[model samples]
Target chain A: MNTIRLAVDGVNKIYAGQATRVVAVEDASAAFAEGSVTAIMGPSGSGKTTLLSILGLILKPSNGRVTLMGRDVTDLDEARLPELRRQHIGFIFQSFNLFSALSALENVLVALQLKKVARPEAEAAARSALSRVGLEQRMRFYPRDLSGGEKQRVSIARALATNAPIILADEPTANLDSHTGLAIIDLLAELAREQGRTVVVVTHDTRMQEHVDHTLRMEDGRVYEN
Target chain B: MTYPVPMARRNLFHERVRLAITLVGIAFSVVLILVQMGVYLGMMNNTSSIIDHTEADLWVTARNNSNFDFSLPFPEHRENTAKGVEDVLWVKKFILVWSLMKLDGGGSENVEIVGFDPETGIGGPWEMVAGDPRDVKYPKGVIVDESSFAKLGVAKVGDDREIYGSRVRVVGICRGAKRITTAPILFTSYKTAQELNPWMAGKTVFLLVKTAPGADVAEVQQRLRAVMNLEDVYTQADFAWATKKYWTLSTGIGLGFGFTILMAIFVGAVIVSQTIYSATIEHLREFGTLKALGAENRTVYGIILQQALLSGLMGYAIGLAINLVISDLYRRTGQLVVQPWQLFAADLVVTLATCVAASLISVRRAMQVDPMEVFRA
Candidate 1:
């Protein structure tokens, strides 16, 4: 009820392969509000990933309109989209995707620098984000030097550093053990329930639905209620 | 890193196979530049050594000829004009002629006959390899450079050698002096040189003028040139350099070898670019994640550039050391010597440019990576 953090209206995405066209997402539409958690749940090929991508602004829709922060953006040019994405949203991937060479703390600072934070201040901010992830001591360690849980925690720190109103997570737990994955879900849920942030998670696992406020099931590029 | 280093650094310590291949490429390329450049420096040094050994403070040649080798003879008595100059200490007649020396072994080699007046400063050879430089005289005698001994296929000090119509004794083999033309040098007495090449008449190729220490050589040369007909005079250093420049300019040495060095730099730069581009491709996902996490496109690109520069610098170090070794080895036999400053400037330029250039394509690809790709599975 606070405000729509993200809204998609009849967004269609097509993948043009050499021999045939595969509709990755068909007329997908959903709205995410601030201070809430939404989940797109489905098995493989359900178009959940595609829907998440369209929301993340990483993938362009073939048809229909998508809006973010109340601006209709489905047809926005690619060149201008990255700046908007960088400024307004944060993305969390299934693999953590942390740079192995950089320390957990350095990974966050790099993000701050990209945001054009002044150098000395960026370092302090990066440390603050790492400490928020309960990783003050672990910040000095590299991704290769960290456990899977630790790496994921560092990734969350990077996302949190973005200070975006919304975070879009794609398959955020497909790689983790149950307890570690649950910890991540609890973290995201806590951010929404207590920190006044919007969270949208895409996953095939029904086990994660309880952590989200609303659940939408997708199958063959179509969305339905469970 | 605040700025991303070059992407190619992944292979810096990560991929042994790739590093080995790159190191090999770098080492061999360096050797190519080194050897080709050695030959170039060798030619310059050869001219310097001969001119240095002559000890002539000034060279008075025929008026329009820049090179003594192309000189038309002036009067042998041009010695009088040089003596009249304020700083001139002594003046000696010197003549040069082309001839063939019949080796003790049944073969013949081309030789340049240089006539020096033994009584004055112009005729003595350097520390003799087998005998003395001045043991021979004008009527019929010669001093051979040591390398010329083997090159001429000749041996035995005091062996008789043939000049134009006269036979001369090979009294000594001078130790160090060599020539640009790669033929042997045979120093004979001034009178004998004129005797062998009768066309030389009373004219000498150059009148070797020595100045009293602290004498103004430039002033003496200026005065001598004005006093003599059909002659130009140069300080010893200028004359020697001019002799070298004669060969360098006339033979296209600078352009030909300059191209080879330039190509080496191009190859180094090309390798850097290709390697960094490939490395960037390998790190695409990593970069995407970085960008997604709030890394600017420029920071991502910067990392790759630093990597390219580091690689280029390493390659240059390896190459320069290799060339140094080659230069050191050859200098003993007086082949070619490479100077440190020359290699330093070249290597610095090569690797710096290589590092910067190699990062270009990789940086572009890095900046182009879509952060959203990380969400695509």
Candidate 2:
């Protein structure tokens, strides 16, 4: 039994208003073990992103117990979650959420700074991570200076530099063409295997299915019957 | 993802157009705060300097008078009555009046005339640029501030000029002389001034004195106030405050600056708030994406805060530089001067206000973003 990197137990999330509670995640349970790539595949209006949000600690679940390496972190206060994410989790967004003014290395360096690494060491690690994604030549260039595929690559390096035990990516390949999407999926698979970390991707793109070690598909805020 | 400081800086300089627009807005406020506050503080300092340059502690004037430097025709014996007060070190008689001075082309303009005792030279002149301050100790000798001479076309040291129908030779230039009641003051011995205006012998303007250190000025003031029975008595600092209160608070200077300073703060707050709000609005989708990808609420909060902090600090720095340069330009024109403490206070207020405004923007927008929007169309 390898260490369970992330485990979500029957998470139920609802968007509540003055009059009603709209259920977004309904009793979804999931486990992403260490050294595995997990995908939550779904169509539009499906609960994949909501489940991912609950798993990522961005949204509080109405009923759930989240365990990282078998520690019940459900009732953990919101303030402690940032430090938790920095230590054990890496996040990648489809929009390449890198700050536009910072160079590629700086974008990754920012993540490292969050990880609480010293300045020089963070910079050196950022450079190596960019080289890992084959963007060594693009380190000094800003996001505006990068192309679509190159930007995604820098973001991937940022995830790598974070060096978290788990990487949570939301449609990391959405902005790229098929070739670039394939490269990113393959890169994520390589990163999981090489870094001995868990990767949880929330996406509808079936190109990720083959690279994923396990897939928990969702539909209409529930796990559809297989 | 986690820059503590530079995150805000990146957003500020990212778009030069926005940067320039934001800076212009901030600069208006900076200039406004600086000039208004400077004038407010400058008025106080000027009054203090006027007192410091004079060798007077106990001032005696005609009963119920407000101005210390203006001509108050008090009985000359009052100077001795003040000197007779316990612990009084020295007594010197002085006079302040305005008499028509003859300029070129037989033209005449009113010039402030200050007369001091030539022996003790109490309330003579200070800060000589071309010559000595002690040069004015000679009878019928004058020390004119450089600015006054600049207004008078082409005059130098050692020039003889008619002041109140008497010829007085210029001893030296008082380098940074300014207008008191909108007229330049010329320094001379009380004898020369009394000689020029014979009415002065009966009416002396000031009685200058010194005290031992640790002297209870309040008790001494009460004793003198009871004995002298003349104008209001005040300590040096109290006099400075009175002059500021008289010029700035009593006059329209305070009210004039109030509106402008408020407008400056409003401009600063509105521009900074709008910039931060604009950046927040622009990044909603990206924020959602970050949120969906396991970024905590604080993580998203940090991004917005970083942007706000960056813009505020940058704009403030740029605005301070501009204010300093503008202050120098004002100095060159010889109208205003800026003090370090005023500048520091303005900066502190502006930066703190900007940060608070930025925090408000971050809280408003960060709470509204839905994490699932990252995956939505």
Candidate 3:
């Protein structure tokens, strides 16, 4: 009976182009609960990433309401969305998206600093987050110098450093080896069960189902519970 | 946080070669602008050097006198007319003409002949390196600047040359007596000048007037104008500025130099814009990630603007350092290249402004990046 941390009610996303119209997500409805890991499994071009983008507040849905912690936020101003995302949502990208110029420690520090955390405290928090991801020894290594698994660990540390309530990961293990991918999935499950943070992952790998608490399937821009 | 990560600095420094090339481009533009502006100012200063260094309170010349180098002769009696004015302590006749000097080797070089009374030392050479200003009183004696030795084909004091086909001995050597036209300057007595150029006899080009102590120079100029109704009257400062204006505006030098400065700015702006834009394009995915991570537009703008400012500051520093070295070298070679503090300040402002303006293009591109792009594999 956990509270619904994030939910989208009949949300629709349409990308209108000069030559054609794309219904990226059509009448999508789903609820993600706190203290649980949910995986949205879908094929290519199935609008899973689009739905995740809407949930992360990175994209605006054309119609329908979005609820976060029981408050409807669908009609919020665009200007207010960034602050809201910064305060509540943490994003993990498929490519790890680490600033190549910064070291792993600095990558985590940037996330905390963006939330206006004090520098002294932000540094400690970044170090602690990196340690939590078991990357304490590789904190000073840049993205170009690290392996794929280490880069993904640094990305997870950056997301964890923000301490956001909801974590939205788009293909978090898409670029990692099978063993490393399972380890990352296990880490996300540990973050949900142990830390009580609602974690939603959009992935095409069926192997993630064994590690997640709930699973949903997406195809042709529609979502179905499994 | 008040101080975010040094992302801008790190980003610029990431590609060492590109950064070096960018800085070189910016520094080159800065140096070009500074040198051109310095040369223009130096030439303008030279145009008015004679009027600026003289001790005369007022200058009376023929009506509609264009500049110090070019003037019509008035009757020598105007000196007496100027002397009669109230508050006028004394007045001396000044002669200035252009003639060819017969070089000792074979060819002739253009020379500006300046004649003033040696007794009063009015309108005479102010900085004498060798011999004396009064030495010009000797018959056919002339004072030449050491800087003009190569052009005039004379080595030192006592060297002989011919002015207007008349033999003249260099009795003195002066320093820093340059003209805007780059012609060698020769100073002589009124008698010797008239002896060499018979056309200037009984006619003077200017009258240098000294006023009594504590007298209003402007009032004295007005009185002299009333007494010599047809001649132009100017205070020393006014005359200097008029000479500068005539050379700067009446001639096309100002327009040419202005065009050069503008072109330098244009080239600098383009270089800066391209560097920043390319850097932005290279890190487009990182910027998209920042946006997806909830960075505001202002933060992105701040980072890019910081990079531009850092580039500007470093480039300007290097350029100024090089300019100072070059200015010193030019000074040693007896070429005046004036770089005042005001010029440095203005150049810095222009550099920063160009850098900031250049960053707008990058900022616009960064703003258009969709945050969702980071999610695509």
Q: Give the distance in Å from residue A189's predicted Cα in candidate 2 to where it truly belongs.
A: 3.9
Give the Cα error of residue A198 in candidate 2, in Å: 3.4
Per-residue lDDT value at A180 in model 1: 86
Q: What stretches of model 2 exceed 4 Å from their correct place?
A: A1-4, A19-21, A118-128, A190-196, B1-6, B31-50, B69-71, B102-107, B127-143, B150-175, B198-201, B212-218, B283-325, B334-360, B367-369, B373-377
Stretches off by above 4 angstroms in model 1 are A15-22, A70-80, A118-120, A134-137, A220-226, B1-17, B47-94, B100-110, B116-176, B186-189, B196-274, B294-297, B340-343, B354-372
Count residue pairs with overlapping backbones in model 3.
Answer: 0
Model 3 earns a TM-score of 0.95
Residue pairs with clashing backbones, model 2: B8-B306, B8-B310
lDDT of 1 at B145: 82
Question: Please, what are the lDDT tens digits per residue for candidate 3 over residues B137-176?
Answer: 9889999977687797655787888877788998999877
Model 1 residue B347 lDDT score: 59
Model 2: CAPRI class: acceptable
TM-score of chain A of each: 0.96, 0.96, 0.98
| TM-scores, each model vs. reference | 0.75, 0.84, 0.95
Second chain TM-score, each model: 0.85, 0.87, 0.93
lDDT of 2 at B65: 56
**Best-fitting candidate, measured by DockQ?**
3
Alpha carbon deviation, residue A194, candidate 1 (Å): 2.9
Question: What lDDT score is found at residue B197 in candidate 1?
Answer: 79
What lDDT score is found at residue B88 in candidate 1?
83
